[model samples]
Target: MLTPYLAMFLDGRGLNSVEIGQLLALITLTRILGPNLWANLADRSGKSLRILQIGAALALASFFVIFIADGFWGLTLCFGLIMMFWTAIMPQMEVITLNSVAGDAHKYSRIRLWGSLGFILLTISAGRLIDWFGTEVLLVICLALLAALLLVSTRLREPEQLPDNSPHTGSIWSKLKSPVFLGFILALCLLQVGFGPYNSFFTLFMKDLGYSGMQTGLLLSLGVLAEILIFLKAGRLIQRFGIKWMLLISLALTVVRWALLAHFAHLPWVLIATQCIHAASFGLTHATAIQFIHRYFGRRYQSRGQALYVSLAGGLGGAVGNFGAGLLWQQGQGATQAFLAAAMVVGVSLVVILLIPSRHLECASEPAR
Candidate 1:
């Protein structure tokens, strides 16, 4: 509800397109710092659950100010503070989920698919609610959900032991300097950068094309439906084809998906087709990234690894994507150019990933390096 509806809400509040993008960028920008800060604290204290609880509470509190936040700076402060805490919440959640699955990357999908279910439910319902009540309904729904998250976080606990027992004795700096790590980070960041326009403006763009809120919601949920199917078989797909090939498939399809959107979004069927490939663009990409992190960062540094991935890829990449999309959009006049550039960026990611050296793969089929 929050992410899909944020730009619309801010737009309803009278913000311009670029300003909306800037605010979204600012939110992601906090992830770059917030995750690292909270991860270090959790690593030292062994209180991942506590930290998440605290962050959720704080984020909930900060977001309430959105109700009254006026003007650019005011909205900036509100979203900035919320995202700072939000960054902490998500990385902790990922760490916990990964630990619970005990390194079975495929099984992680079983647990994660529920999130897609909820997203579908909320997105469709919110669309109907918005159709009846207006985007202002978003504020109330968002607050309710955040409050529920705080309530849920209280009941969460750490796993009895982390998944990996191998001692993580190497310096983080040394690990960070590896060619594979560098390549992975760079490619993933660029892939996310390629997601900028869709993430920030897809809904508004659809609205401009004369689609109703309910139609837009259905289209967004259609993507998540594809996401759910992919998550179900993600582990098998990765195992059969290998992470290297799977990533290649996902990135290549992402290139196609965005290009189609660039040229054909005005046609409803094209939008539907692009939505269908979200499984590759997001669900598969995310599952593989988690697999890579789980392998690269050992138990001791798992939280930090998660934080770093979230910060660099989701944070830095997302910031560039949002800000760049806003500029390319030029208040809806250049939607095609914005999406076209996104396709090109992902194409670059495809090239870089292909050059990432397919050695050290765990199996003949899968690249589990």
Candidate 2:
């Protein structure tokens, strides 16, 4: 919801593409340290739920400051503070969610699918609302959602029993040193780098093509709706195809998706079709990656492993992508080039995915019933 409108909000404030990209990059930059810092504290204290609640509270407070922020630096500082806490929320929640479901990692998709639903709901409504009211409504809606998140956070309880019998048998460092794990992280980073253009500017791209805010929102929602469908069936797909093939397929689709967006964005149907690829590009890949992280890092290092994943793949990777996309985007012909460059980046990710050992791609173990 907030995501699909954030770039637009920045634009409405008279910021240029470069400034908006810089602000987005700054948000990702903090993810490099914020998640790890919070996760370490949570892991040491065995208080993930409490940590998440604190982060949520801080995030809400920091975001409210955005209402008063003026000028580039002020908005940047406020958004940065908001993201510092915001990034802390997801990785810790991933740990808690995985723990609560026990060994059935597949069940994660079912639980997480609700998030996709919420995103779709908010995104579509926000788009229409912005169309009716104005971009200023973004702040109010964001505040409302964050407040709801804060309220929800208070109700979440920590998982009582953590998973045992994780397949990996080495220290976190040793596992990180493994070729498969290293390759996987590298692939994830490249994939995120590819996502930079789409995440930062896709809505703007639609707007440039003369699409309304509601249209842009619907398109974005369409992608997540596809993602939700994939989530419902992700477990069975993983069982059949294995994580390696799933990732390979996703990366391959991402390349095509970006290419389509670059060359055929003027065609409404073409745009709609391309958006559906989000099912594989994000939905399957994310679910598979989470399970892989669980398997690779095991229980002892779960929180930190999730932190590192968010930091490297989502943080550094996204920062590079956003920064590069900003540099590439021009008044005209720039969006095309930016998206093409994105496709090329994900192409590299595909190669990295192929480099992982075949055995590593297979399911490590059946989910405990």
Q: In order, what lDDT does every prediction score?
A: 0.87, 0.86
Per-residue alpha-carbon lDDT of candidate 1 for residues 227-276, written as tens digits (9 for 90 to 100): 99999999888777777888889999999999998888888789999999
Q: How do the residues 101-165 of candidate 2 rate in per-residue lDDT, one tens digit apiece?
A: 87365688899999999998889898899889989999999889889999988887889855467
Number of backbone collisions per candidate: 1, 0
> TM-scores of all models?
0.96, 0.96
What local lDDT does model 1 show for residue 143? 91
Candidate 1: minimum summed lDDT over ten consecutive residues — where?
A: 360-369
